[model samples]
Target chain A: MAGVRAAVVGTGLIGGSLLLRLRDAGLDVTGWDPDPVARGHVRRWGVACPDAVEAAVTGRDAVFLCGPLPTLSGMLARVAAATPEHCVLTDVGSTKAEVAATATASGLGHRFVPGHPMAGADRAGPAAADPGLLVGAAWVLCPGPNGLASFRRLAALLIEVFEARVVPMSAPEHDAAAALSSHVPHLLAGALAGAVQRSTLRDAVLSLAAGSFTDGTRVAGGPPQRTANMLLGNRDRVLSGLASVRAMLDELADALRAADAGTLTDRLAEGRAARATLGERRFDTHQREFPAPADHAGELDYLRALGAAGGHLTGCRTAGGAVTYTGQLPHTPDPA
Target chain B: MAGVRAAVVGTGLIGGSLLLRLRDAGLDVTGWDPDPVARGHVRRWGVACPDAVEAAVTGRDAVFLCGPLPTLSGMLARVAAATPEHCVLTDVGSTKAEVAATATASGLGHRFVPGHPMAGADRAGPAAADPGLLVGAAWVLCPGPNGLASFRRLAALLIEVFEARVVPMSAPEHDAAAALSSHVPHLLAGALAGAVQRSTLRDAVLSLAAGSFTDGTRVAGGPPQRTANMLLGNRDRVLSGLASVRAMLDELADALRAADAGTLTDRLAEGRAARATLGERRFDTHQREFPAPADHAGELDYLRALGAAGGHLTGCRTAGGAVTYTGQLPHTPDPA
Candidate 1:
């Protein structure tokens, strides 16, 4: 790990934090950002700030395209062409299906492992970056056809360097899950805020606002352009998520109007049960090993199944032609 | 206020807190709870624990009927019958319309002022009560046709004793506002939780849950029965709020499918604008006086207007046949 060369393109909060963490982990890391101000911050932190993306990726064993959604596909294409054939590629974008398709179209499918790290702060830029951001966070990796080996390499590095839990799934699986868990929640918050703003009792409503309103609308405080990018970038999945939620709201409205206490209580109880599981998450480790190289397809299937079951890889190592993966089994609470 | 006699019935979190605050303000306060364990807690706090509701409310200047939604009307009837004619009665209930109607039907409209103190915690019962809970909270009082004088007396006492901001509005107004700010948010949280629970990728979704998901669904963690009671009690308003929110979701989904960036950005910006107002609230005092007891209806209209405009009463007093009220005008940010 000490001699492994890793390049980070896009030195914003996520990228800068990864650069710092990779450096601290003793990897030979070089970072590149188009913004001169961001590049200056990298140099100030004593990390190499390559003036060009090509200079950063050349001769590196791994390259991370850590840019915003709109810039990701271009970064992927440029970085993939510049890096050596053996180099593994990954990106820290919120959505995956579109970029994964771009990589496949460019014949870089075998080297590119699509990813999203579930960590951030309200503030942006390298100055606000903290290396501690990635610790114990869930980092999702979507490994496509012929990408299992690359996923293994990147997942292993992330696990060892940042102590991040690696979750493996397909690109579409990641997008749909994110739509339900993250994208739809953002839209819901925005809708709630918009409704309150248009109310005739806006002032009084805001005045009487308590914990519920504040917590529910907290995500709507982010920049509209950024939120719009993430939402629109994952349009199809978000649309489906919105449809599901609207149906839920319709059922709830009916229950309330009909005074169907049974239906209402059942729905609320289900939600409470689900929410209870959130607080009960404990790191109960479970380990599994697969004979790598020889059984690449089998290993990929196993990792996907583990991720689908809510398990995450804590450690991955290739020794004696075998990949020993350490992970935690999902905690299943009793039925509501 | 030293010799004022105040009693709290059906002692729980809200009721117990009120009792402690009243006693702290040098009032002779008595409390009554059906549960002996709660009575023991009141005694431990060195406050009087009357054995029955009749004993608690007898000869009191003001009596607060603090209980659950289902038990409130019954407590109001029992407390009103036992208390002296001059005693001003109020109840700590989340929804006001139904209870206010009950008071009117019981022919205690003049003395009964419906109230809801916008402060609480996840924990319940006397042992979990904190006198500091009422500090800096918005305490809404709905003054019916003949209830202005009673509203003033309670508002003044609350302001002086607990430093609570007093918001005056009609029962319908309070219910409608609460539906948008509190009840509907609870339902949304529940719906989001339910959606995640029902997803095939529930484990992966839960694994990737971040700040937005956690904050948006925090309120769904409350007791389902209590949440159900609130949503059902304010059925019509909750239904209307749900309809409005569902419509917003539909519009958002349409924009996402059609790639209508302008509409999407505008909607998100509107939400961000509305959410921005939540943090910009600051108290700037304004004073007004009305010749009370001479033009009671005029004073009521003024108070209602103040509440509608997001103003809150900080102080109230009667001198020389005039009621002087100190309030804070709403803080309005420049339009987004």
Candidate 2:
């Protein structure tokens, strides 16, 4: 670990943050970005900013290609040609099968380990680089043939240095799973948001938008070209994912059209149960108990007062003539 | 608003919350719920808990039918039967067209004002009643013939007492808009979540689930019956929305299958722009300026440390081998 030298090509958010993460972990890291401004910022971080990509990777122990997916293969070839024979080459591309294929054809497969970290921010570029960006995020590893040792080493580095959760899978498996877990969701959000954007009553709909709309559409705000590149790179898997989604929507539509309460209820219940397990954690909630009221109107008053005071009833029970109500307080502090 | 006597039927989250909202606004409210536990909560709140639905509406200035959509017409009929001649009747049903039609057929159209509050909580029942739930939420009002006067009165109550945004639209318009805004998004969430639930790799997929997945699935976790009721009540509009959604998804799928980068990028960009307008207001971020660094690696290190220390770079410049970075500081306090 002490003598590890890493070079990051492309200083966008992922590349930039990765360079900093390596440096902060006490590794000798050099970075290169085509943009002068991005390159300059990387230099200011106390890490070397080589004048050329070749100079940056010449003697590196590990070389990371974090360029746009479309240009990854070229960058990988160039970086591989410049680096030492033992220097392991890897990438942070969202897609993998193509990269694996390219590396195999180029005879660099043995030295290549494909990886895709499940993390990002709304912002982009080297300036947005943050070592903690990858913290607690899932980093999927898809090692190519004869690259197991390198994959293990890189996996160790990601976990120990970046504090990422390492998930191992084949390149095809990664692509398939990502299609379901990430790619299709983004496409759906984009589609839904796009549909709304084209509507004549867009403003009216937006005015009535709530947390549900905002949350569902959040990922649709990603950079256009970048999103499109990911979708195209994993075209086959994405198409498959889209098929599954279409089938699900069709079933829902059928149930709705038929007014099949039983089917609708079953689907909704299943969804509720599934979503409940996704996060596995939530912020601690504040709770309070209030005394019972004299009648329905009184109970309403108590609830309103609590709500006005930024609380919500979680539970309530009556004993004798009095009732006790428990509720969760608002997360945000009351306005001063 | 003083001396206005109101009666509420059904004591689920919405009904219970509404009763509380009115009573807290200094109105005398009586309530009745078939569920003994729900009725018990109303009684404990200090508001009159009438044993019979008729007793609750007998002398009220306004009667709110807050029961399920299927039972709404029945409750409206009963309330209308017992209500005084001048009593105004309103409802908090999610769908307006059906309810409006029912009221018209019942010969109580003039006295009925169909309203739907775009608000809710994850939980349900009287125990989950929240007064501030409607605060700042859009409350769509579809006033009937003589219901205009009462609609105005109720709108004022909603605005002044509950701090809700009153939006007026025809019953048909309300249904159409709601189908797009709430009902369909909800169904989409349920469908997506359900798809994941039925997957063999549900656990793995859920484990890798990110903010996009969680946000898109949030509404799917709502009570199944409640969700089904809303969807069914707005069946025709919901079906239209579903058709639109399906068409959008199909277009996206076609683009993916054809590997049309241009089309995909255009759609993604369109979605991003539209989503940008959904939340009109956002917190003003804070920016900070820091001196530049001598090398790219150093700058990266600096940026990461700043991010770790809760900050973000907004801009950077280099002069004479040195660089300066401008960034936004983190909004929250650093953890000890």
Candidate 3:
């Protein structure tokens, strides 16, 4: 990819990582963040910090929006107002349909390309910035009619810099897929974790809990507004995804209630197979995984106490999932 | 915890990991594994190798039978033949109610204790064993009679050695919990992973899949017969759990069908909270969660090729509730 000047909005996990990656590849990049904390975060990552989004995107060849759903439109409006006419815009939000719709309705459609880079970690902020964050990961690009072939070219360029795979789809397909791949599962995990309380022996529950619980609930720890926007934003597609999930679940429930052993086995078998295939490609950490300093018994204890207070359970000893301990904490449980 | 003499039967992941833990704490321990491969695996972990199950538990004070359900009765028969009058035989099977029934039917009721250790990896066998495997994990002890006091003492010893917590529940309750905690989730994951073929954009789906897909399906990668036993042994409870899951899915589907943002948001919110709690606890892993091994890729490839050849999806990649890619090499996709 030729040298690309990019402006990263949000300056947190995705954006910060992108900035690092862009610079690591010798690309000239600047960052924009409204929050001092976030700006500081990007500054720490050695990216050129600009005072405002308008200033940042006006001169950059491409503007990358990388914050939660709510912040995207506001920032886009700023970009629309001052961005050079030739500038291309994209985002790394979880949902695309809604974000795309909002952009069109806001009349910033021409300059914006509806896109989502599918890569990140549970912990957010520039401190967690990884140049390889999107390495070999999928970057979903949903281009509007006015998004332009040049925008498409920009998407491919972003893919190379991030070392990511680009999958093209409509805003709605992206929405349903995200719901299928991310949203509904997160919801299921949140509800499952939430239903557990002091009365449920949650500590004991978590101790015995395995990867299934964590995977089912990974999205629960995300920013509520961000997750809500994804849900409320792509309402139709998400709902559609949920409906398919519901049909699958209802059939399972009936089979169980009726004591249909064959059907029950079949269902369990089905889930087993789903998880198996999905987990089929495990990455070799050619590099070490947890850079987490030696185990902190005290911090672990503190987190445990907090969880207990919420009728939630926590663990700090084994490192399987949730390698990071920070963030909003998981609130939702998908019963399935 | 007082010093204890323990014999772990069917020494695989749980049994071997347990035995190593026992010996590390200076307890007298021995292992009995009829499977030569399993025996070698257990012996490598520093556990005493007993000639047979009867020999292992005969003079030993406590014995833990940790294998699939089909072998439980045979194991019990061996225990009955050579058990000391006060010996307590416990199990580490996923399901408890039926296993307890098996003990009763086998005429070893009082001397038999039904157990399900909540702590374990989706991976199995001694190759998967580690001394700290059960540390900070939970063990469910469902004792049957007074002779169980001795075993309870041994269990307490285990609790201290492994640094794990304990939960008390009847066999049926244990099964019900396992159904919720383990079985149903496995089934659901299998079904979900089953829908997506490995060869279908393998690079893109996997590169973008992230933690959720991997974690959700972790259980599906378990041993097939072991998985079969979990489903059948706790068939009733598992069936009920499936019903509940199906019900939840149905509700989600309904909301989607009606395009009810309000209800969908509410449901999503509930799920979010549940997942957050689980995420907070960090679920099963307290140490390292290796991304799914590359072997999963092979399984996917294999299934992809198999599906191509047979015009159907293959369930080889999944088991338990997680996916596995370790054991076999996948065939190329094109079949002549």
Candidate 4:
């Protein structure tokens, strides 16, 4: 679609990345941004910079409006004023109900399609944008039956350029899913961090926060406005998601309070398997597991046998005398 | 002190890391691990491998037991059998109450220091062990008043190599703090994953799981055996931690269910500021952010203004025309 003309509004990470990818794919892409710095940055990122909206939107086949949810409607109103009746309008926003409602109220219902790129970074602004950032990511397209063809076509183009898979669903379903998957999780991470910061050891523990804590709260620290809009705009679903998470905490509390090693073991086992499944996603694609050497297996077996025999061992060290894995004492441990 | 012999009782990550650091500081250090593979790996990782516990412990002036909770007491018993009368013993575990109890009950309390290394990884075994992993970490040293001097000496040695801050506290306090900081969070992550797995979009949504979801649930998917032992080992503390977390979640739910945007924003903002404090740790002293062209910032700002203007913007073919950020047209977003 080198001949395809596309205009991207917002020019932030999601929209900016999409525009950059389109230009790289050799499509005719014009970026329109009121912020001179944003415009200059897009041009530097290699997208064609347009001087005016008419030069960018009038004849283009498609346009993507991706910005703060609060700014979308106002931008969409401008898009309506300049674009022709056939120009396809699409958005990359986390929430659907409000955007869709506002559009319907404004009578731009016929030519718009709602889409959300399920991928984002903790960083924002144009500098954080990457041409291929959305590649291999999932993009959900919410379109009515009448608008499916055009939306699918746009999604297909996205797939070719960004390597993103398109999952089509109803708007409410998309909102609900996002509310649970993204909005509520961010809120929870933030809340967790907040609670921990209240502890006396906040400085001590937070300093030692490893990959788990970092990753757990990564989104919590990212673009505040985006998260807020997603939560309040999708209030119903987000609240329900919060409820779901609370229920989970309740179950875990019950299990831990019960102090049944069996149950704890079972839960941990389940979580272990689930994380393995999750690791298949892009983030942990390069995860490495360093299992103990095969030779260690033999040593373990031999030690077990030694214990079984009349021979009791005090402790056995490895060859270099620095590594240790077990403690075999002559006496049995007391039941705690 | 430099001439003293030291025995490291379990060749796991913490144990192995400590042994290497001690010996590198000029102390005579020997390791005791029965699992041959771990022994080999730890040796390869630069730990001194000892062949027998009695040989390793007989003359050692200091010993650190680093292993699973179930094995701590048993190891202490063996140390009692062969260790010199002045040998000071310690442990590296997540929770401390159990270790303190075991050490006291095993008849080795007077000679042992029940301690815990607050640093570790999601992965375990000798290979996953890093020699400098505990460098700059927090090592909680909990001991009865009688063993304070020996324990502080041990901690002082760690400070030279690992640069870890030695925080002194009672075993119960250490365990309670750990429950709040670590165990409860792990349980929450696992439970969140479990909840999603049980939701209506279990297959669809999880299949579309991205970095955020993977991150949010990372703690849930840690080692099964370790998690189980850690959670149930200090059952009361973990349960109390669960209560604390539950209360926080409930507060969030109420705020959301009530459509209190102000409360949500406050929570999100607080989390954002607190998470920012993470940068204070300076753990990644060796790494830096990838540099980008300096001019990109100015250009990005320009684009924001264009998107904000109410205008019809489409594609590159309409070059010279700019699409602005504006509140003019209605984008017909697909309804749910």
Candidate 5:
């Protein structure tokens, strides 16, 4: 672990932040960015900045592809080809299904773990990068059948070095959950912003906007192109989530129009109860250990189940060839 | 304005904060709450705490009713009966139209100004109040016929003492704009929070709840009963705004389902553009003076027009019986 070498390709906000975190953790980290400006910023930060993604990832124990959704597949393929056989691969893309599929189709699934770090800033680019971005963030890692060992390696770095909670789930599960938690929120924010802008009382609406309006539309202020890519990349799940949200809204509207106070109050109370289950920004961890599965499918199923139940892998160890995975679960059994 | 007497009825968060601000401004202030705990808290702050609303508002130059929506009408009626003739009565209810109607029905419309301060906290009650809550917050005042002088007096207190921007509009106009800016946002937040809670991946979703999820659902964390009351009070406008937002969301879903990147990107960009129009929290003021209207209708129309244009009344002056109203307008003509 002390001699572990890592590389981060595409040194924008997320990647640059990861690169800095890894370097601060005393890992030998090399970084690369297609944008010369990003690469120059990394070099100025006193980190190794290789001119090529291939050069940066060569001989690294772990390689992270931190490109936009549209570029992830190509970047993953190139990184997969250049890195050593023992290298564990992951990406910081918001959506995971497509990337995981691309890796599996290319026969790189065994070593590739599609990941998404649930953290960001309003600003983008390397200049806005800070190592603190990953601290205590939930980093979801979708591990395939043959990628159990790779998941363990990558998750250990995320947990121990970056102080990130490593959530293990399948790519499809990850995508569906993300649609509800992230993508749809972005779309909703945008829609709210757009609706207010188009209102005849647009100026007045903006003037009267309070905490609710500000918080509800804050995500719409993010880079539009990136948000679009995320919603589009996870199109099916986002569509389903959007439809569900729309129906919920329509129901509330009907209740309001009908002056059904009982129904409206119940709906709002349900929401308040649900929001209370979010608990807090950070949670107290209760660790648990499980014997690793005997095969690939067994490993995948076990990890997915644990994550579905809100458990996160901390690390794993092998004693006499019998692997054991250690994870942390919240003390509260049901958030509800 | 020195020695001006002010009374705040139902000293909860908004009322308590106002009572503190009024006292700090060197006004003779009295506060009362039906709840003994709240009245006790106000007394602890070295302010007069009256047992009855009548006694609290007696001889007051300005009286503020800061109770829940259901209690507002009764409180307003009681205060109207108890206060002196020169007293300018106002309420901090979220909805203006209904209360304004109630005041008109009771023949108290001339002295009653329906006002809503666009500031709040997660916690409620007098103990949670902070004098700074009203600082630089938008305080919407729906002024009607015969209330021009009353509006000017109350607005001067808000502008000069509390540092609140006084937005003048009609009751219906205020409600409609608020639906888009505040009420609808609250509904949307609750809906989002509820949807995630009911998701199959509820735990995973909560674990991955980042800034967007947190911000999008923050308002859902407020008191459910109060939020429900606000939404129900402004039911018609909220219905309209919710319908419009539903259509926008459904359209985005259709675009995502069809993989219509062009339409999706365009929609997101529009939202980003719209959100950008929110601009800075505080805007630079450009003061303008207008000759006071000769009639009640003229005054109401002028004030509503100014508020609709995102301008706020600052103060007014009279010389040789010629009244002139001075207001502040943002330097930027169009936020968009």
Candidate 6:
């Protein structure tokens, strides 16, 4: 592993983060970015700043194409034609089918490990990279029969270096799952934000928006082209996810229109249960209910106490001047 | 405000929280709940627990109807018939229009102040109440002409006691805004969660779901009946909001189908800008990028360094076996 020479193309958030992790893992790493500023920045960080993609790819143990989809496809072609037989190629991209097809066409499908790290940020560029970004995140690898051995090696390296969980699956499965987890969520965020922008009291309403609205639309803050590209690239799955969402909404809408409280409550309960299952993986780990004090100052003190207990107050209510609070208790499961 | 003797009918989250806040502010508060357990909890907390709604309402200077839509409507009728003329009534409900109409029909329009607090939790019940739940949150007050003076006094009291921002507006205006800011978002959360639950790789994909998905569906975790009541009660505005969201999705779908990156980019950018504007009110106030170092142990140290600098490592990359990190600096704006 110490002698493993790896190269990263595109020094943006994902690429930059990968490069940093690789360097920290004590790999012989080379970095190439189309942007000279990015290249210079990596150079100053002590990475072997390559002047050309070919220079970074030549004789490398692994070459990770970290650019946009088109850039990665082009680099795959270049590596397939010129890189040494031992230079296992890979990529960190959202979509897999197209990339897999390109790698297969290049006769390097077996050697090309198609991967996607389920981690990102609103910002981009090498300067936004973090070695810890992918830690504890899922790293999906779409492996073809041709490069099964290489994919295994790459997966092992990823686990050891990035401390990421390697989930191996087919390209189609990866795409389908991603549509639900990432692609559709991005579209939903945009649509919700768009509705807000179109509201009659847009500014006033937005001013009143709290944690729910903000959290619901957090992904919409990402770069326009990046979001659009991911959504379009995974079109089929995105459409499928959207259809499911639309159908659910229609059900809720119909229930509301009919004033059918029973049906509405049933559907809402189903959703609430589903959300609770997912809630376990939230930023806060454990949730518990406690007695909240019936006073503003006491409430503040209660919040501080929760924080000191490695938790934070998430909800509060009062009845007859007696207050209660809900908070996430770290490392502790709810007795109920 | 201290001399105010207020009665709360329905000792639930909103009602309970309000009762606690009012009592903490030195008001004489009485609470009544159909559920004996809830009434007992508040009674033990020192609130005068009345056994009957009429008993709680009679002779009180203010009567806050804190219940579901139907309960609130029913209480308004009873209050109109039994409460003293000087008793100013108010309600905490999601939909203002129907509540206002009901109050008007009951001949208590001037006395009833329709309010909607823009704060909530996934859990409900009197046990979930927090005195500080509404602190720093927006509380919309829809006052009829007859209750203008009373509304002003109530607004002042809410501001002082609960530390809530009182936004005075018409009932219709309040409903429309809530549709965009609260109601629609709640429905959207359910729809998204439902979609995830219905996906082919439901469990697997959800396991990979990150902050975006979790945050996006946070509100869907609330009790089903509560969410259904709110959405169904505000049918018209909810429908309008849903229509807006559907149209936006349609546009995005068309662009994605056509592979029209330009249109998709434009829409996404629009969303991004809108989210940026709303982001100012976010609890997280600082975002700065810092340099990360190379090496496993050093990587941890880098994170500590960033933390010490009031920042956290967000991104990292490596070149030539040397690592670099990116992190957000506290109170510093991100420089592109």
Q: DockQ winner among the candidates? A: 5
Rank order (by TM-score, best first):
5, 1, 6, 2, 4, 3
lDDT of 6 by residue, A254-322 (tens): 988898999988877777777776666443533333332324333334443443332323333344544
Candidate 2 or 4, higher TM-score? 2
In terms of lDDT, the poorest run of 10 residues in model 4 chain B is B310-319
TM-score of chain B of 4: 0.75
Candidate 2: residue A40 Cα off by (Å): 3.9
Q: Give lDDT: candidate 1, residue A160.
A: 86
lDDT of 1 at A197: 83
Question: Model 4 interface RMSD, in angstroms?
Answer: 12.3
Q: Which lDDT value does model 6 have at B280?
A: 60
What digit string (tens of lDDT, one per residue) describes model 1 on residues B1-336? 898999998678889988888888889999999999999999999988878879878999999888778888888888888988889999888899999999999999989999998887656789878878888899999988887788878888889898988999899999999998898999899889988877777888898888788888888888777778889999999888877777776676778789888888888888788787887777678888988783677888888898888888989988898889998887665699
Sliding window of 10 residues with minimal summed lDDT for model 1 chain B: B245-254
Candidate no. 4 TM-score: 0.74
Which residue segments of model 1 deviate by more than 4 Å? A1-6, A16-30, A36-51, A59-61, A121-130, A292-294, A319-321, A332-336, B1-5, B16-29, B35-48, B122-130, B291-295, B317-323, B333-336
DockQ of 1: 0.71
Q: Is candidate 2 or candidate 3 better by DockQ?
A: 2
lDDT tens string, model 4, B128-203?
6666787766566665645544543565566655666555556776676677667766776777777776676554
lDDT of 2 by residue, A139-174 (tens): 776655466556546766776677665565567767
Model 3 is docked with a DockQ of 0.14
Sliding window of 10 residues with minimal summed lDDT for model 2 chain A:
A281-290
Q: What is the TM-score of chain B alone in each candidate?
A: 0.93, 0.81, 0.77, 0.75, 0.93, 0.81
Model 5 score (lDDT): 0.84
The predicted structure with the larger DockQ, 3 or 6, is: 6
Task: Give per-model TM-scores.
Answer: 0.90, 0.77, 0.71, 0.74, 0.93, 0.78
Cα RMSDs of all predictions?
Answer: 3.2, 20.0, 18.5, 21.0, 2.9, 18.5
Return the lDDT, model 3, position A8: 82
TM-score for candidate 1: 0.90
Angstrom error of the Cα, residue B316, model 4: value is 65
